[model samples]
Target: MSSISSRDRRHLTNGVKEHLRELSVQLALLNHRVSAGAGLKQVDLDCLDLITRHGPIGPSALARRAGLHPATMTGILDRLQKGGWIVRERDPEAADRRAVTLRAVKERMGEIYRLFGGMNAAMDELCEEYTPEELEVIAGFLRRTTDAGQEVTADLV
Candidate 1:
């Protein structure tokens, strides 16, 4: 394989960073619109997304992942529960009898998914432009970027 020159590598890296920043802002705006459409606060929707992605998760774990305080998480959880977007149930497998886990309410997910349908469709169309190998590389970069963000968030917390 041919190696990129240092100058070219730096240029590519700067371009990627600039694109990522722009992507972040655009994603935030999209999420804000989605949250408004769903009648949920941005943080609450974000927490629900975390639970949907990582459930059945404990409240404490979800709080950590969302970078929210436990008390704040409790309020978010309560709202989600009241809205029928999520449920808290005793973790039968947990050794601690009272330990509860958060789960996204499957039946209620349709509303959220519908709100995101446009974005999902756009993303699918975007993915159609890339070959599988290129998509894999892009996915790998995104996964690594997400991990790095989590690590940095943990440090900040």
Candidate 2:
């Protein structure tokens, strides 16, 4: 590889910074489009994703994992149920009779998956050019960035 001068390095870093900001905005807009295209709210899609990833989980645990208030989660679950996007069942081992667990309607996920799957497939192909070591660094950077955002969000309105 050719050596990059300090001046060139600064320019590349600035480009990456600007591109990352643009990516963030683009992702927000994409989520809005996907949500609308799927006839769902962004938060509802987020809840469904969480359930799809880690569901058959109790609502209280799901609410905590999602950073949503219990009351708000209740409404989200109600919508998901009415949309036929989720399944709710009694938590067999819970002492509380009202305890329930939820899961996404596995067969109903196709539209949401179809809407957002292209970018992930493209990103996976792009990652093929990187060596394992470089990818690890990229992954670490992303995790730290997510952590930083969570820290800031903890302080937000």
Candidate 2, pairs of clashing residues = none
Compared with the true structure, the alpha-carbon lDDT of candidate 2 equals: 0.90
Per-residue alpha-carbon lDDT of model 1 for 1-157, expressed as tens digits? 5699999999988999999999999999999999999999999999999999999999999987887889999999999999999999999999999999999999989999999999999999999999999999999999999999888877885
- Candidate 2 shows a clash count of 0
lDDT of 2 by residue, 10-58 (tens): 9998997898899999998999999999888899988988899998889
Clashing pairs in 1: none
Q: Please, what is the TM-score per model?
A: 0.92, 0.82
Give the CA lDDT, 0 to 100, for residue 148 in model 1.
98
Residue-pair clashes per candidate: 0, 0
Query: Model 1 has how many clashing residue pairs?
Result: 0
For model 1, the local distance difference test gives 0.94
